[model samples]
Structure formats: structure tokens, C-alpha cells
Target: MGKKCNAPPECVPDYSKDEAYLKTVIPTRIALFESIKGQQLPHRQSISGNPIKYSSFTIPLNYSGMIILRNGSVKDGKKWISTPLDIAKGISKDWGENALISKVNGVLWDMLRPLEGDCEPKLFKFDSDEGRDTFWHSSAHILGQALEIEYGCKLCIGPCTTRGEGFYYDAFYGDLGLNEDHFKQIASGAAKAVGEKQPFDRIEVTRGQALEMFSENKFKIEIINELPDDKTITVYRCGPLVDLCRGPHIPNTSFVKAFACLKASSAYWRGNRERESLQRVYGISYPDQKSLKDYIARLEEAKKYDHRELGKTQELFFFHPLSPGSCVFLPHGARIYNKLVEFIRNQYWKRGYQEIEKQEFGLKPMNCPGHCLIFDHRVRSYRELPLRLADFGVLHRNEASGALSGLTRVRRFQQDDAHIFCREAQIKDEVKNALEFISSTYEIFGFTFDLKLSMRPDKYLGDLETWEKAEADLTEALNEFKKPWEINEGDGAFHGPKIDISVSDALNRKFQCGTLQLDFQLPSRFNLAYSAEDEAKKERPVMIHRAILGSVERMLAILLEHYKGKWPFWLSPRQAIVCPVSEKSEPYALQVKDQIHEAGFYVDVDTSDRKIQKKIREAQLAQYNYILVVGEKETEAGTVSVRVRDTRDLRDESIEGLLKFFRDEVAAFR
Candidate 1:
């Protein structure tokens, strides 16, 4: 979860509380939204209201401006009056009809949000990430409306999935429990909202104003209180629902042509079990029915490869209520985990994965804090400028319970965490090397990934100039690699800018499993320094924080689904199994299995009473990468018949030759 970060992060119903205190939840929430909208709205205005305070630009009478489109073309527009949608319409009817979101000066601007001044605007369709997020975000509002109208449940946080497939909303229904039986009614309500063509409108208010607006809903109130008093809060109203959100949602509800309620489950408020329990309903919507149908098909396919399900069936891992958010890796799962750690440790040691300079980092349970302590322990020379320190120690985090989905987000996990200390001039080379290492590791696992330069967030801890230099170095390293990448504005850690790496699995789902971050704050805090060439000079070194396999547990989950439980040979716990043709060959099969085991690979002999074909089929179904069959002929020749999983093509080889092949395959990391 820490690497690239999860997109939108999920529960159950309660009492069958006889009647579950099924009191009708009043329409106060909607009335409140309308009340605020009324106060915020200018009388006698249209859906796109004229701004009273949001705009910083002062418009002259009939003020006219030009919108610089992405293609270097300019269109006549009026400040505080013309919107991106207006410009899109002028560009083409197709762009106007399908534009889901817009970007103004690199900021995600809602299509309906008015242009403040002469500015550059880029329109995006559903094909782009921004557009898809806006679409799904709006759909969540629709779902929230339906849930409120149908069950009077209190709506909570709702957003699109990490992959932009769909969205889900978490809500509290008191003791009232929910099941699939309610999906049809929910869908009906959602469809009704789409038919209404309600436009999504945004408004900003002070803390007191926001607190008053959501006074009737304790959940929204709780969220409101979490914000700083001086912060201006923005709320988006769609139909009767005015949600607490920072949004650039779709222009209106009519955009969703197809909608469905996928499933319902139980959740805890804010994902805390100690808090109020809630109901979580998942849903999806699309502009057209065909895309919805295609998505439904893909969902079914994805379920077959769901890591949680495969983990159970493959006897790899399991989760229990007693240890929520953490997985219990079985022996087989442990084998894979150990191998991954061992593999990475060996790679860094051999390849000299290091920074251009050296300094030690400090620790506050994380690797950096401890590494700093070691560096500061004694006076250090410039010769060891690039000190590479790696940690395999377990790190724990108090992740939200509802947010925990399989191993992707967990309370307990191990990271391939390491730190590099180098001189300022060496930053780019260190970053470039880290990028290359990331690519090589992903290539070994057959993964496709997206690279992003996450910029300094709103709140940061270093001098502006230092932050800028770190960002520039990372940017240069990315350009040097010559790969396509994008910027994730205001998405960096508070300490510094970072290079985020999101690995895409077989289903094209993205997981943030690796990142290389440049830090100035921590190094400064620890006062880590090294002797320079100048006899009296002591220079502070920069620290590069990195973790390639951000949670071995999470990566295993991604790999599980990516391969659909058929692990690649090197990573497979059940590398091979020998099946005896009959009692006549049982002894020979056992001998072969023992020999393979002694050679340092996982192997087993199937001594069951099942026939030859049945044994082979069972072994393949169990996902043993290589299946060995021994019979009278094989026994006579000191050889075994080999069959590959999925492709049962058989080839006979001597026992010694087969072991050599197995060793090569494992060593290749294929």
C-alpha cells in the first residue's frame, strides 16, 4: 500500500436486532445539501452558478478570454463564464458528448468547472485515468443516493477502485443487516437518479458552515472535525446527496447509461472494528451498456484469479478474525516468501546496489531511523559515502481493517527496505540505477508497470530549494531511462518527492509495490555527515529511501492472481512431484523423489492407490510445475517421464539429467 498507494480503499450488516431498529432515516441529509446549495447558489442562476467567492479572478463587463487547448489551438472563452465543457463542445460534438474530465494547467479540472482566466485545458475521455476516476466517483454518489433512498442508511466514504473498474460506498445501517436480496432495489434507485439528470455542483464553506451543514449526520460531522479549522472544505451535491469530497466528478448523472450493484458486505466505520459497524455495497457504472457487459465478463474472469480465493485453494495462506489484516502463511507460502527474500538479498549483494555517496540512516522502527543511528555512531570517511544498508526485519502498521483486502494492505508485513547515502552530485546516477533494478526485477516476474514522478505534497518538511533539486534529479533519472512516465501532482511523501512504481498484473490491475524516494529531511534530522576531500570539511550526505518488493506478502498476493495460482518454476513451492504408475514402480518413484529432494528442491512422491492418469491429473490440478511419472520402463533405464503443467507434453530423461534441468530452471529465475 505504501509504494504506489491504493486507489479507493471497504463491511456487513448487523442484527436480524429483530427489526434491527429499522427506523426510517429522515431525508435530513438531502435537505441539508439543498439548504447549503440554496445559500451557496445565486438567485435566478442556472446549473453552472456564477461564483461569488471561489474565483480569484475579477471579470470585467462581458469579459472575454481564450482557452489554450492541448493541441496549441485557442478558442474564444469568457473568464468566470465559459467552462471546459464549452470549449470541448466547440472542439467537436464527439469531444463534447464524451468528455469525462478536464485538466487545467495540470490540475484535474471538472468539465463543468468554469475557467477562471486564460488558461490551457486538456479534455479527457473515459480512456484516460482521470476521466475514468471522475466517472466512477460520480457513480458512487449515485449509489449513495440509492442506498439512502432505499434503506435510509448513513453514507460514508465512496470512491473508485484502484484500477477504475467500478466503485463502492461504505455506510452504517444500525442493526439493519443487508444481503444480495437488496441489490435489485438498490439498482432501481440508482437508475432513477440517472434518469433525473441531476447536475453535480460544487461549493466551498468555512469549518463552522460545513459542521452546521452536516450536523444531522454524525458520520459526516466526524469527518468534518478531522479537518483543520482554517481549511476551506468543498462539498459536491448530486441530486439529494451532498457528499464530503474533494472532487472533479462527472458533469451530471445522465452520463451513466448503465449501472449495477455488484455485491454487499459488512464493514466497520472508518475500517475500525471498535467503531460503529456498517454496510458496504459495491457497484459499477458505464456510459454504455456494452462496456458494462464487457466489464461483467472481466469480473467473472478476475474472480477465478482472485488471490484470496487462490491462496485458500492452493493452501498457500489464510486470514482469520483473530489476526485481521495479517496473513498466516502456510509452509508452502513460507517457501515462496523465503525464496523471494533470499533472491533479492543475493541480487543487491552481487550487483552492489548502492548510492553514489555514503552515510548511515536513523531508525524509528523503519530502516532509515536505525541506519541513521549506525552512521552517526562514529566519524565516517568520504570513501564510504554510498553506504547501502538493507533490512529484512518485519514492519507493522495499523492499517484500516475494511481497507485490508488480502495481502495488498496488511497490518504485518516485510519490505525489501534499504537506504543509500550519497553526495548531492551523485543523486541522478543512484536514482537511475534503482529504476533499472526495478525494471529487471519486474521483468523476472513477467510484470508490466507504470512509472510516475510524485511531486512534493501540500505539506512538506524541507527547504523549497532542496525539494526542487531532489525532484529535478529524479526527473532527470526518469528521462535518462527513456521510458514513458507521468506526474502525480501533490502525491509525494511529506518529506520529499518520489519515483512511484505501480506493477500491473495479468488482469491489468495495478499494485503499488515499489518506489524510490529521495529524502533530505531525515538526513538533516540525524545530522549525518562524512569527511570530504578537504581535510577539515564535513559534508552532509543525502539519503535515498527505497523498497522494491514493498511487502513480500502483498507481492505474493499479486503474483498469485497474476499467474492464477500456477507459480513459475523458480518460485513454485511444489516444484515437482513423482507419481508411481503402479505398485511395481512405487519404490523407484520414491527413490527418484528422495533424490530430487536431496538436490534442494521441493518434491513429493504420489504413493496413493489412484491410477496413472488420475495421479497425473491430480498433480497438474495441484499446480506442481513438473510432474514425473515412473513405471517398469523408466525403472529399467534409471530415467523418469516428465510432463509439464498445463501442457502435458511428455519427454523421457535420465534422473541425473532431469535434476540438472530443474537446477537450471530454478537458477534462471524464469
Candidate 2:
């Protein structure tokens, strides 16, 4: 059947079947969208008996336009001009193909969209964040198109994400289950669309027309009806799919060279449990196949180190449907978690910080409000200028069920959280100390980190001067550290400027686990005051909120993934295992385990009926740092043979000698 249309050619699909095309055609759910693409809505009617004529639209013959380059160069000519591509090619041929999007007069614009007027334009490529976001977001559209065509899915929302999380699209596929088995077909359809090089044409329509265009999909209708009347309704068309969006998409589908469907999961509509659930499909795309291969490799590595799987294997932590986001830490996991808290608490005492005990009725998502009460209870003096209070309070947040993942996104967690009440004169010093503390602490774990200072946001609460002062202090501290740092403009909390620390793991993936915010507004809000040095008046003290390990649960997840379940000896839950060759050596093995356990090392005695070698293998699989084997000769000689987890053998040493070496090794980690 032939499809007739009066719309521009670029607005329609450009599909071609080669000789290798499938012999059997699989029908798609595209007719609903295609019916309205090239025709006017029912509203365009003739009121009088005479025929009505609409104005003919055409490009001017001698359209003159000016282009502004980033280098302050201008290109002006008398030629027909519309899209950003025309302006780019007119300026320089090299920029025509790779340019991702343009910022015209501070508004993100699609390269294929016509320019409204002579405006300041900034073109961006993949290196720019704006460019990467637009590219990935457009990739989601391709994924959505493939899903709709292949399964007749009712699409909900598709968006791109940063921080190594690529993109996902939520769709309601009634009774049409999807899994990894369907990924290959979805990927093939998406790749075919890209090969067609269909233009992503943008169209502005009335709200009534938009409702009519997507009337078949109730989800789309619900979204359209909820949009405000003053909001402009725009839609983008590429290949066989049309979507309602306010897009700054790439010029065409061909820009996407490599793509893959990662996986699919269940999600509630608009993240509400009471509403209908949808299948959320996740995928990623890259500029080339090489990048995609690298990403796939990283993904494979990530799966091997996934905390949920590793937790089950290592017996670290587990989750139950009864308590959705709260983890049930096993004995071994609790030990490790407690050690992390103890380490941070020791630092508190050494850095002139006082420990504040948690209260009963005032517990909340953060311990800041309780710490505020502590500062207000006593009349502090400038002599005690920077009074630091530390807490390891348990916190609970009502994270959406759909958004919950392993330890990374959880409901219950503890933070190595603290608050420092300092005078204006001490802000710089306090922030400097916090940075140094972070560096020293991460160094112990062999973590290399990146630092960034977030400036005052548009809706910040404090006076401009205070925000600027806090920002200047943080900047100076960062500069003095003599390391590379980035400024996240307008990304600060409403109350203060903050410094975020992102740690890169062994796999070169980054996780943000530390934050230090200098708050001028919170102190005033809590009415926290201290006696001035003049001794005649009182003033509000600045509150600095800092967390070295933002969430202990999330940090544990990062460490598990980073080390691949092989923790350092100092932090390992099972530092060593005592295995005896025979029942005759069982008594000696028990003695050895007692010595290690009494010396503050976590050790277990394995007296299973299994052979010694088999026992050693089991311990290794459990990620035990050391395995000590004892037999008749070693027991009589008061010595033991120690084998490292990675098959490295050590010489048999006397029990006393072994104790000295082990203590020194553990001390080195501290």
C-alpha cells in the first residue's frame, strides 16, 4: 500500500529494503503515528461555501544571514539560510558533520532546526557536556523507536543520565514480556533506522492536534493533558516513530553509529506503586564501535563485581522484599561496617572533634538538626572558635522503590557525618583541614580522587556576599592543594557552597563519596550563636557539614566493586583462616585461631571433614587474606605455615614471629 502525504519530504520516513532484507515482513505499530504525520487535523475546515486557501511557505531566494563563530568571527552572505547546518557549512565545512548541537542566544537548538533570527551561536562537540547529553538523549529516542516498532509498546519516558549511567526508556508492553533474548532484535531494528539516515524533523502543533496525533496511546494523552496551556507543544519525527518532546536533537539518526540494549526491568508508572507498571529498558550508544566495545567490556567487568551478587557469594549483605531498601548485614558485614565507623570516629577525636550521641525521638534523614541543638544548648565562645561535633547516626530516607538498587541507593544508611561550628575567620582553615582529611583518609584505601567546588545556585538562601565569601574560601583551599579541580557552577545546595570529592576506583569508574559544605544560612536558621571576641555581643557561627564517607552502605558497595571482593587485610572481615591437616592438629588450630582473634584480627577455625587443600580453597573463595595450615610437626615446633590468598607461600615461622609480622602489616594500613 502506498502512503500519500503533503508534508515536507524531511518530515517522512526514508526506508529502503536491500536484497538481504527479511523475506517475511513483521508488521509494526506505526500506523497510529503515520495517520496524522502528513495531514492536517480535523480542525482545518472551510466555514464558508468557497474553498479556503492557506499561505504557501517557501525559503526566500536571497535570504541574507549572519553567523557568529566562537572565535569572534562572523560569516555573512546573501544565500538561502534556515538550519544551523547551513550556518555551520557557510562558516566552515569541517564543522558541518560532527557538530552535535548549537546554543543560539543561550538556548539549546537542534542543528537541523531553522534559526529564528541572527543570534549568538555556540557549537559543541562530544567533548562538551552539553553535546554528550544531547547525543545520549537522542540515542534514547532511537531505542524508544525500536521498542515501539518491534513490540507495539506504549512508551512512557526516555532520558539520558550522567555519571556513567547511560540511558533508559520506560514503556508499557501489555502481556508482551521482554528479556535479554529480545535485545538482539531490538538492537537490529534500531541499527536499521540509523542506517536509513532519517532526519529528526521538529514540528510545533496545537495542543488539540498533539492530543489527536497520540490519541491511541493513553499515556501520551495523560502527559499532553497535564501540560500547561501556555507551554509550547513540539514533536520530533525520525524514521517510523514520532514522539512528543522539546528536543535539541542531533541532525539525523545517522549520528548514532554504535548501539546496544543492556537490559530490561520492571518500574511503576511515574514511580508510583498505585499506578500501572512499565518495563524499563536500558541501553547505551557511542560515537563509534570501538567506544562501544570498551563500554561493553567495562560492563562485563562491572557485573562480575556487582555488590548484590558478590554480597551473596561473600556473605556480606542481603536484601528482602519485606524491607525493600534496608540491607540485612550479616555478622561479617556488620563487623566491616562497624570498623569503618570506628575509623572515622578515631579521626574525630584526633582532629579536635567531640562525639555527639544520637537522640531517641529526633532521628531523621540527617543528623544535622540534632547537631544544631547541641550547638544551641551551650553558649560557645570565639575562643572555642571551631567546635566540631561528630556523629554516626543511622538515617532513613523514603527512596522510591523503582529507584532502589543495591547499597548505592538504599533507604537506611549511616554516615561518617559531622558538623563544625566556626567563625567567619576560620572558614578557610576548616575547609582546608577537611580537604586534607579526605586526602589522607582516601590514601589509606589507595583511592585517587577528583575535587570540585559547587557555587551558589540561582535560588540560594543566603546574602550574595556571604555566598561569595564561602565560595572564595573553598576556591583558595582547592588552589593551595595544587591539584586539578572543577567548578560546578550553580550546583550548590540552597543553603551553602560545597566541595564534592569523586573517587576513581581500580576500573577507572568514579563515585562521589565525600562532601564538605560551608553553610552560612543554616546557622542563622537554627539561631546558633557564639560570644564575639569583643565580649560585648553575640554572632551566628558558620556551620560546616562534612561527610568523608557520605553513606557507609554506598561506600561499602563501591569498595566491594572496586576491589572485586578482595579487601585489604586491615579491613577484611575474615582476615585469616586456621585449617588443620588432620583431627590430631585440631587442638593446635584452635589455639592458633584464639591467638589471632585475641590480637584483634578476625580469624576462624575450619574443622570440616574436608581435606586441608579443599579447606584452603574454600577460604580463598571467601576472600580470606591469609590461610594458616597446621599439622603435627608445626604444632610441636610451635610454628605455622601461612599461605596468602593468591597462592603465594610464606616460610613457616614461630607463633611469636608470626604475631609480630601480622601486627606490623595491619599497622601499615592505618
Candidate 3:
């Protein structure tokens, strides 16, 4: 019954149509079988004119598979495999250039180079780390060409940087030195090189050929002579210039669409201080125009927030060449600094932490030794497992003058430091509490921060097992907090694992402000322990070193730049300025100032015989929050005309009412 139904209803085709359907289906089925057979077939074949035989197959990027040769030898392989030009030719017959590009790690490598063996390949885009380095390295060659054309400078070494925007090259500028004035000429020359759109041609040469090519430049010759005998020498050339380099550069010079000269400095050759100094020219380039614009805007904004300039303008701090790396905080600056200390002291007091003073010039470079002295002063019990001690201690380090910057890098600075002596089992909880304190303090300053866990350095002091346990404890603490943090491998202190908090300001510049360090070695070094509940047991207590604000002076500088000299009412040294309209109202203004002073405000009466507008302008320039104008109308009405800074609106309110308003604002700190 089913066969009959197909013949009439399901199979509606006539005899002729049935034959056509069969013909189409049979050929497709046969073709599928043939294609599958071809894929399984061995590819050992010789081209018409090629001297070597080759094998070929389709492979995906980064694929892991096995290749079985005709000789019964089996080899594990990835998408990338080491082969000579003959094998690549055979593979090229089946696949296109895209496969080759993926095989060589997305690099524009030479097609004839032999692939010797199988390995894992990494595909790269323009934004990948390796890709960016390759692009910038090519750009450095272009820069060398431009410099040669413009200044006739002898290039020594140019390399891409890991931390900064782009690359820098060291060169000798003959007798004339390169400075800011030469940037325009160098940029113009670079633009010409970009316009030429020349390819970066790579050439391999022997030792004799390299020696003859760079004989005129002694620096290049010296570097070449030191190379190992088995190493291959290569040179990259763009336009009319060539240099000795080991390169994986971009295809051509036209990729350098945007460029700029950042700075010029003097640096010793190979970073050796005893060697002769060469002129180092720094530059940055981008493939897109918008990236270049964004970089320039950030640089300009940084100039506005340059702490050195703001410190001088606000009369907050100063540095002298005699002291080099040390800063001298003025009286006004000291007022802000001491107030911050008081505020933190109050915080510690509320948190049940004991405040203690430490010696400024101690035997060690850190406060750990002094804290040990206090910890050992008296016998402690197991009940005091997490004893917190606070200090505002000054520290100094021997820093070179060349490494000094504004407030970010200084020799002498004070740290709002604390140490927690706790049992080994309480390490995670103590670290979590410390992090919470740091986050809350940063929130008060309206800053967003990131955490970094720094591991032990090469020159560490503790045993491997102890360091492992300390690292594990820190990892547990971070895991409990459940916050994302970056790892700075091999960058911690000698004796511990540490966490650094880098806070970002309004302009998106980061400043290092807080740190939490775990120290097991220091307690052992100082021989610190507490008696356990079991009368016979005494165990070493772990030490936690933490700081909310690394340095008061540095924090002040950052705040000044962050707020642009406009401090909040509570933090401002001078909260309000009372300016009398004329000499007649001076007495009333003085009385009003006294009233505000009595209300617990910092107020000053401007007794200068200048015009009222000049006095208001001066008050605004000083960044005072409020300017109280006392004239005949104000005195008669028992009101003061209040002119708020950075605004044009004026409010007429009674003296008592105005004082109350400031008190409320100061309390809120808005």
C-alpha cells in the first residue's frame, strides 16, 4: 500500500522527470565521494620545473593535529609548521596567502623562508601587543631616515618602549645639540618620508658585507662586531636610508599616518652612567589621526596639572637645586599637611587604633624597625592578635637627581603609615579590612583607584617556602575581597608581597597613594612573637604594613592640581574674605570678620585702600570661597553682600545668617 501511494501522490514525476532526477542525484553523490577521496590522497608530487617534492593539506589557524609522512614517521603538528620554500609552494597551490599569513603569526614574512618544524602560531591584529611593537619598530626606521635627511645625525640605537606611547632613538647631533626648536624641522622631514610610501625592505648580509656597509658609523660597527658567529645580520631600509636591525616591521612607511615629537633628553649609551651621553629624541606615531589627537590633548591637559607649576602658583611648596630631590613645604602648605594628619589621626582614634610617634632618622630605611621596637616594648597575649598601631612617620631614600620629579618622586616624605600585628590565621581578614579603609579614604577625595599585587623580586630575602606561603596568604585575601587586580610580577619589596593602589585624578592621570604589604620575614628578623593560650607555646606574629596616603606633601600637590587650586570650604586656608567698600565701612567689616572668626571660620578683612572691585578680584584670585562686602547699605540693614567665587550672583543676608550659611557649607564641604 505504501509503494502504491508513492507512485500516485508522493512521486508526482513522470518517466522523463524521474530519469533527470536520478541523473542529478547520482552525479552529486559520486562527486562527494571523489572530493572525500582527494582529501585522503597523499600529496607527494613534483611540480613541472621544481627540484623538490612537497606535501599539502588544509589547516585551520592554531589547529592541533598529527601529520603522518609516507616513511611511516608520525609527528604532532599545529597549523604552523617548519618547512622550506618547496613545501610552502605545494601548500600555496591548495590554499591562498591568507593561510600563509595565519601560519607565520600574521606577520608579512618572506615567502621563501623555510618552516623547520611544527609549533603553535598566534594570529595578530593591529591592536595586539606584538603587532603594535612591530608597527612602531618600522616607524623608528622612518624616523631614522628623516633624521638623517634633516640633521645629518648619526643614529646609534632606537627601540620600542613597553610603558610609553611610542619609540625613541639615541643619536649624535655632531657639535650642534638638538632642542625644542628642532622639532618642527624633524616632523616635517618625517612627513616627507611618510609621503614617499616606500616599503621596508629587509636584506640579509654576511659579516664582511655588514662591516663594509656601516664602516663610516663606528657605533653600528661596534655593535655588529659583538654579535655571535651563528647569528644572522639583517638591515632594514626605507627610501634612501638603511640601518642595522633585527626587524619584524610593517609592510611600508605609509602606515605612519600621524606623528609627533614628544621630547629630547640626554642619556648615556646603553644606560651606563660612565659612558658618554648622547642626545635622545623621543617621538610617538599612530596609524589613525584620532589617536594622535587624543594623545596630544592628554599631554596638554597634563601641562595644566603639572604639579611643579601649580605648587609655585599657589605658593604651596618649592624645590632647590642644592637639595635636588628634596622638597621644602611652605607654611601655608604645612597647614594643609598638618590638618590632613589631624583628620587621619581622628579616624584612627575612632577605629580603636593606638597612635604612636616614631623616630624620623632611624637605623632602617622604613618604619618596620621602629614598629618592631614598639611591638616588643611589652609582652603581648594571644587575645591581642590584631593590634593596630598608627604613625605619621617621615622617611628618606637616596634617590638620584636625574630621577626626581614634582611630588611623585621625592627623597624626603612623610607616610600616613600603620602596622597590624596579627596571628597567621587572621591575615586574610586584616588585609580585607585594610583595603576597605583605603577605598573609603579615596572615595572621600572623589577618586577611582586600581589594585596591583606585586610579587617577590629577584633580590628577595626570604626562603622559597616562606615566600610561597606569604604569596598564598595574599592571594587568599584578594580572593576573599573579590575585586579585580593586576599582577606586577617580580616587583615587590625584598621581604614581602605588596598591593599598590594607584588613584586617578580628574584629568585621568594616575598617582600612587596607598599600599598594603604582608611581611613574614620582618617579624622573624625582629624576633617578634606572642604567647598562645596554651601556656607553653609562643609563635611569631605576622606583620601587615599599610598606608592610606603615602605622603602628605604628595597628596597635597595632587589635590591642588586635581581641584585646580579651588579647595573646598573646610580645607581652604582662607575660607572667606571680608572686603569693605570704603574706609568708612572698614570698622564694620572688622567687626563682621571677628564675628565669623568666633563662629569657627577662617576669615580675613581686606584693609587695603584699593577699590572695591580690585579687592573682590584679588579675593577671587586667591580662590576664597566667599567675599563678604560690607558697605553703608549692608551696615544699616545688618546684612552683608556675599559674592561667591566663580559666580556673578550676589546675595544680601544678615551677618548672623551669612555666618550660619558658611558654617553649614563648611560642615558639608560641598
Candidate 4:
């Protein structure tokens, strides 16, 4: 015997410390929830039996006030003074019960949050962005309540996601095996709370009172201690649970009519991997079950078109633990990637852009620094003011492992990046030309995109005069497009303003991939200048950073999912496959293959022992653009039967004619 091969108990394959711990503490957690719910958690009383203090409103009960609607009109000319919820209920019989949240004087106000004096009110429905956020954020609070009730978990942060994705809540569960099995328990608890229609009663508390109330929970204590002195501390109570939050929640838990727990994952405390790990639960809620059902159906469709799954099936790319967040593109994937770059390069030559040489070592994450160096290499003429430099430089970012996905969120990638240096007077024309370039690029890909001018952010560089001029230039440039555009207020980069383009995919999902930003800081920082008419003065040039496809890897992923792996002839990695009906037609298949290859197309012959029909079926499964079958009769007639990817047959066409069709399609993109 080889030393008996004995190991410690920890070496057992079936051992899981978290599972054992969860099994032990689950009963106690449920008992705690039952204990809390048995007693009424009144808004006026604290756990310490001290009466909670709340501020009183100064508005007189007998005073009548004006209620201004969003449409620049007053309801009934002048209405009696009431809360925002009452005003909403007066507008429509069921508005108060159905509306997600309200807006008073442009501020996101809660339904029960009292309105002061004469107010302009607007109610948001669940369909709008604001409404969706409020509704989902309220659902997150309910999730936290359920978690605490089911697992005695210490609550952390629960907030709505940016960009309308969804909402999630983070909590600390000590050695608990939280998985899909427990999602139903959590959902049941949340449903019970929703059925109770508990009001989201808000109460202001002092730091001492809050600390005393939550002394047992260390996470809450930490949050309360780190808060700024000027920040107000508020606690929200729903049914038997209370949480510390700055909330403009819905009127009641009933507003979250449709709810479900999505999934659970482990995260570090406040995203620091060195700290104690926590569990983050993601969920989504809707006002009705039908809407939730529709979303679920769409989600199922999304899973089918997921790029990671398709990438494996199509042999496009893969990820390894050794180099997480980075993708290894196979031969076929590289072909499509290179083709995209070549298409953009051809556009560069046609648009008066000169390709610049990239750096050898110490490569930067962006091409701006290198392009700036090239611009300053040797330049001193007003005629060369608007110099355009382009590069497809490989870049790397150290993204956290938890945030890494397939191609959508990756670490190493390349951008269709370029920088244009020009005089301030040519800002408008440069922006106009850039907008046109972006539009043309999207049109070629058959994408419908929307443009918006991102204004100056709170923290930005350069003088206000130059910033204002750049913003005006971008605004004027957008006016020339002759299309309806919106303004995204105070969302520009730290350097300067920019025009962002968001494209809608085939699934009706929006992706913000293209941008053209005006930068006045980079050129000045690099000391780039050009000579004026006098040939003595050095004037700083304005730099414009633009990208149409953004990242090559991300664009490939989007196209893979957008087309569901059925690529068009121009972008397809494996354009055509030649299949022979029998062993005797092999020579004819090779001849046809050679003809397609001679015309600069990617073609291969199926020499396997399978039947011609089987070979054609495999080609279709492989997502080849075209399948060509050759038999004895076609071999003698010098023709091939063509079948498209989706089983559409094009009887028999001459080899030259088929090659011409593919060439024309490829040329259109070029």
C-alpha cells in the first residue's frame, strides 16, 4: 500500500463548512423573525422602548394652496392644501395606488412626503426610467427585509442599478449556504410583507439614537459612524423590519405587486476583496404579473442569444482562470476581429485620416498619449491644423474578477480609436464630420442609433470660456444633423463635453458604444501647438477623441448575439463550405473550392465520409453563410447547387456567379 493514503477530515470531498453552518442557524433566524413580527414595530417606539422624535410640518390645516400640474396648468384653478399623495389621488381615482413615485418642483418626492406651499407636481408611472428606479429600489428594501427575516443577515447597501439594468442588495450572512433553494423562502417572506400593504413610514433619528438602536449589528454601526456631520440620518420602517436609508420609497409594499429573486453571489465588504466577503442578492419587480411574465420570456430569449454560450458553440473565444477578464480568440474569431479592423481602416483612408505607428513597449491604455506625441513630432503650419491620427492599439484594464463577463466586460481589448487636433475655429466642422462618420458606420452595420450632447460634469478641467465654446460648438454641430436629439445634462467626461451615441440592438437593448469628446486639456498638457499666420506665435490645439466601434472584442460579441451566430456574408468568419454528394464528386468540390479561394474568399471542402446531406446539415449548424453541393451532373455541367444558412435553396448557380455575389457583399462593407 502507498503509505495508506490517509488524510484529515477537511480533505473529504463532500465537506462544506458553509452548508453545515447554515443548517444550524436557520431555525434561530426564523425564530428571530417570528419574534419580531409577533410584536408590532410601531413607528413611534424604538427597540429600547424610547419614543422616536419626528419634525412637525408648519403648514396650517385651514390654509388652501395652489397645485400646479406638469402641463403648466393648475387643477381646478386653485386646489386645497394637501399632501402630494392626496393631490395625485385627486388627479385620477387610482393614481395614488398605482403611481410608483412623484416629483415636486422637479425633485423626486415620496408619495407620503408632505408638499409645502404652492407646488408643481408630477407623478411618474412604472414605464418611465425614474418610475422604474423607484419601484425597483423599493423592491430592494423589501429584499433586505426578507433576508434579515430568513437568515438573520446583517444588511449593507441596497440600491437601484444605474442605466435601468435592475436592483440588488448586499448583506452579510455568516457562513450560510445561500443558493437558489432559499430564493423561494425569501420570496415567500417578501410576498407576505407585500400582501400586508405596510406603509414605508419614515422617521428622522439622531446619531446616538440610531447607534443605540442598531448596536448589535456592526455593519450599521460602521455606516452610521462614517456619515458626514451635515448628512441627515433617517430610518424607514416596513412591517416588522427597519432599515437605515435615505429614501423616497413608494407609498406601500403593495406597489411592488410582482417580485422574484434572481440569483445570489459572493462579494467582499464594500467591494474590497481583502475584507470579509458578503452575499449580494439580485432581483426584479413589476407592477403586474403579465409584465413580469413578458420580461421572463425575454430573459429566456436572451439566454439563448448569450454570447458566452454562443462563443463556445461557435468556437469564437474562451476565458481561463490564469488570465481572468481576458479572452483568447480562436482562429475563426480572429478572422472576424481582423475584418472589422480592416473595414474601419478603409474608412480612415477615405475620411482623410492617416494611420500612425504605435509604441513598442510600455503601451498606454488609450492611443491619446501616443497620438499627441506624433502630433508634436514635427508640425508648425496653420494648413496642418486639423491633423487626424488613427490607431487600433491593444489596451488592458485591471477589472475586478466579479465584474468580468465574456466579451462584453473584458480586461484586454482594442478600440477603433483616433484623435483629431485642430484649431478652435474649426471645432464645429470637425464635430460635424465626426458625427457623420459615426452615423455612416452605424448605418453600415444596420444599427439605429440616437445621439445626445453630454454637458459639462461637476468636476472638469480647463477654463470656463473654452468649456462654454466647446459645448456651443457641439450643440451647433448636432443641429446640422437635421434629426431630433436630446441633451444628457452634466454627464460628460472630466476633460470636456462630448456627444454620445447609443445604438439599439436587434433585441431592442441599448448599448452606448460610440462617443466623440472635445478635449482642451490633453494638448495643453502635452505642450502641443501650431504656428499662426505670423509664423511666430504658438497656439494650443483642441483635441477631439472619437471611437465608433469602441472595443473590437465587445463589438464582435454584440454582433455574435445580434445575429444569433448567423453572420452575414461580409462578416462571417467561415463564408462558404463545399460539400460533395459522393466520393466521385470530391474532385469537383475541390475545384469549386479553389475557385472561391482564388477570388479571395474563405472556402473549404468537406472530405468526411458522411453523406452530402449530413455535411450540409453540419455546415448549417456551424453557421456558414453559404453551403455549396456538387454532384456528378453538376460536376459535368460546371455548376454547384447553393443553399443558404437557413435551409433556403438556390437550386444551381455557376461558380463565377456565386463568387461575384459574395465579392459584392464584402465590397459593400469595404
For each candidate, what TM-score against the reference? 0.85, 0.78, 0.69, 0.81
Overall lDDT per candidate, in order of appearance: 0.81, 0.79, 0.72, 0.78
The reply for model 2, stretches above 4 Å from the true place, is 1-131, 148-154, 172-185, 199-248, 320-322, 456-458, 463-465
Judging by lDDT against the true structure, name the best candidate.
Answer: 1
User: Candidate 2: worst 10 consecutive residues by lDDT?
Assistant: 54-63
In order of TM-score, best first, we have 1, 4, 2, 3
Winner of 2 and 4 under TM-score: 4
Instruction: Say which candidate scores most in TM-score.
Output: 1
lDDT of 2 by residue, 1-670 (tens): 1222345645433222121111112122234344554453332222212322111111111112123333223343211135567556654566676778877665688987755554556666665556777888899999988987777667889888557456889987655557999999999989988999988877677888787777656788889999988888988888767888888798888988999998898988778887776898899888889988998999889889998999998888899999899999999998889878888887887899999777657548998888898888888889987989988878999999878999999998888889999988888889889898999989988899888788888678978988888898888988887767766677899999999888988877878889999888778888889889787899999999999988999999888888899998878898989999999999999999999889888999999989988998898999888899999989999889899998767679888888888888777873
Assess candidate 4 and give its TM-score to the true structure: 0.81
Error of 4 at 499 (Å): 3.9
- The whole-model C-alpha lDDT of candidate 1 against the native structure comes to 0.81
User: For model 2, which pairs clash?
Assistant: none
Q: Write the per-residue lDDT of candidate 3 for residues 360-473, one digit (tens) a residue.
A: 556235777888889998888989879998887777887656667888778888788899999988888889988888887787777888777888886788788877877888
How are the candidates ranked when ordered by lDDT, highest leading? 1, 2, 4, 3
Error of 4 at 137 (Å): 2.0
Worst 10 residues of 4 by lDDT: 54-63
